[model samples]
Target: MNGDDLTKEELLSRFLQLEQRVEELEQELTQKNKRIEEQNEQIEELEARLRKYENPHTPPSKRRSATPRSPTSDSDEDDDNVRTDGGTPGRNDGHDPEWRTVSDPDEEVEVTCDCCPECGEDLDESVGVSPRLVEEIPDPQPPVVTRYNRHCYECESCGTATVASHPDCPDEGQFGVNVIAQAALSRYEQRLPYRKIADRFEQLCGLELSGASAWHATERAARAGRCEYEQIRRHIQDADVVHVDETGVKRDGDQAWIWTFRTAEHTLYAVRESRGHDVPAEVLGEDFAGTVVCDGWTAYPAFTSNLQRCWAHLLREAEDVADDHKKGERIHRSLRQMYVGLQAWLETDPTVRERAQMHRSARAELTSLVERSETDGAVATLLGKIEGGLDHWLTFVGEPAVSPTNNAAENALREPVVLRKIIGTLRNDHGMFVHETLLSLLATWRQQGRNPYEELKRVARDNEMISRAQAVPVVEPSG
Candidate 1:
């Protein structure tokens, strides 16, 4: 009814009813405002995630900056080779000379002075001999090509023919085993594609080889060194600890993977169709028990009896989590503390009992952190992962066998990734096998500081394994 037509009592009643309706609408608007604020918080958290870093050591400013890298830098060449070969040290005015063994001295002119400058006469007999070392590698001798001929003879009476087989020559090909193995090294370890390898071979060795021939020779070397490859597999399986990693690859335009199983002394490579648990199972075998150090991959934990989750990966994730959530910094700080605690203890080389004490402190910190009620979203997710994977991270506390990082395996896989980028993809099954075999042997030898060319020569002769100078020794703890 219209307000003008209503009486005083009726108007009062109508005003009261309208006031109540306005109050109801205000309450509903207040509830919706609360929900919208909560939603805004969530949106902010997700937006922060876009700026998180994949590597903990990387700076947030660097990641957030839109500036592109210089055109001169190549992504493939920017990474550390994951090798222990430290670069040459700078020499000052006065420093002790570092000693190194000289394999070949270009020219040893006996630098002896037969004539004394002060005496103005020959004093060969009076001068005492003093020697100083100068090391240099002369220009390499030109690579030469040689061929072997086998003589076949027939006996008149029996009408039978016999031919002599050369130990260094392949039955079906003209190239020697050494050249073939070198070609394999060029392709797998040097990160060269097949065509480039062929070009380099002709330029350096003056040997005219087609791209197909070069690839075939590489495959032949891989096949001949089967025994050496098998030995490497056994070495990895028998070790007390193995670091495992995989990189993306393609075969005939289909996605595939290249896996590396590494120890302190040996490395083994396997190319597989899938990144599932089956690939590692095929390599490490079911029921195989040892410390498997890997990143936060679920497949590793599924099969490992004793696992050491990589702290480096954890650190990376923590950096991202902290950047993206309200309680991220807190969670990341706790992780860093745990990592530093264990890292400090390991560096100290503590006794077994001391290790237990230090680990207890770290575990206590982790437990206290996980119980906090301030986390949500990404930070909360990270906490759950850390809490669930506690045992995996703690395996290295008292055990000398386990390494704290899966970087060794990643290093082993680096060259292969580069090779994949160059070649685009593998052609067929046999090509894939050859790639795996030669890469395993080449990587193993280089890791041990041995000459792969010499190793290949030894394998082609079908000789027993020859001992090479060990760069890193594999010694079992006496307990």
Candidate 2:
């Protein structure tokens, strides 16, 4: 009945309407599909981000053993890969025992058979003597503390008073210079808290020192070496190249930073409230003339334009980036290739002047890498850092005095880092002052090849505050 009632035109219109409806539904479905694809891509991106960005300071032993070695990281070209016998584990069969070479025996103890046991015959000095070296420490003796008496006299003629005192003894103080120095050295170098330091002094030196007394002794040592600390700061300023680094420190329930500055002649440590540019400014001063080697910390760039960004830090970051995906691997490998090339360049031409020319050729590739950055990811973030600090990154290649990494500063900072871990924090500003001054002086003295123990003793007994020049070390350099 419907076919009979409807015209041919009406039938055609209904078919057209149905076709239009189908096209509209298809367009709506296509938009929704596009959005779903975009969402999936974003989810994958996030997942990759999560998989990457492992701790930079994580030891290689702690990393996931199941993760394959980065394809770009492996190289068969290393000389270590050349055909060689797999080295046997542990010590070799030819290992010689590290024996002590005795100089002269302190006392000669003779073991002699005065009479022949078998015959009961008297042997008149007939037995030859056999000597054996036995090394031993003498019984613990009372701490040898030498006291010097100082006498004051008054002259009747001019009413003048004078006192005669020993140079190695502290005036008016009961403890000898040695006691003060050793106790202070133990506190800082050994990272012992005052109570432990007091116990150590009491046990080892037979001097009953209270915790407060031990702290006072260290403060005195710090005061004596204040000149040396200042001298080290000046040395860094005048250095041809200086390495700088900062590490976290907790102080009195608050946070602080321990900034380490290393020069050819000295390593100086500073404790400050902030890990900002001001820290370096305090060390290097404004308009620092020397080359600065540092990590990619934002604070460092603010200090000096002549900066050598740490290649090791960058490489580790690259590895972190490469941990998850092909993009990161490509980035890591590309950066690694540049590092290798730069190293080869340095090896071929070790002179400082040759650095600029060596890196001139690689500029374009570096620029390309920097110009291209990821929106949000480890690889992108790392590339962003490199891009932002290209000059700093490449500076070492051109400056021979500047190393490619901040290892020198890092090594110098290790002492205080251990100290922080042990002692936790300085109680107040005075504590910070003592810690910084003594550590800087001790580190500088050690670098200068002076005996830290003896140097410390000499520092404690000085009557007049001396200039660094006046306090010049007389002791010969030692291993």
Q: Largest lDDT belongs to which candidate?
A: 2
lDDT of 1 by residue, 1-479 (tens): 67788999998998899999999999999999999999999998976785453245333322443334347756675344222233222453587877776566455665656677897787655345575667655553466666777788875755556565555555667777667777877877677777888888877767678888878878777877877888898888788899999887898889888999999889999999888888878888786777899887788877775888888778888887777675788778877876786777688788989878866777777778778765367777788888888777778886877888887987787778778868888888987898899889888898899998888877765632121112224445555
Model 1 scores worst on lDDT over the 10 consecutive residues at: 463-472
lDDT score at residue 243, model 2, on the 0-100 scale: 89
Clashing pairs in 1: none
**Local accuracy by lDDT, each model:** 0.76, 0.77
Candidate 2 C-alpha lDDT tens digits along 373-413: 57757667777877887777777776666788777888888
The regions of model 2 sitting more than 4 angstroms off are 1-54, 57-104, 114-131, 144-149, 153-161, 350-354, 373-376, 463-479
List runs of model 1 lying over 4 Å from the truth.
1-105, 108-147, 153-162, 463-479
lDDT of 2 at 130: 67
Residue 165, candidate 2: C-alpha displacement in angstroms? 3.6
What TM-score quantifies how close candidate 2 is to the native fold? Answer: 0.74
Q: How far out, in Å, is residue 307 in model 1?
A: 0.4
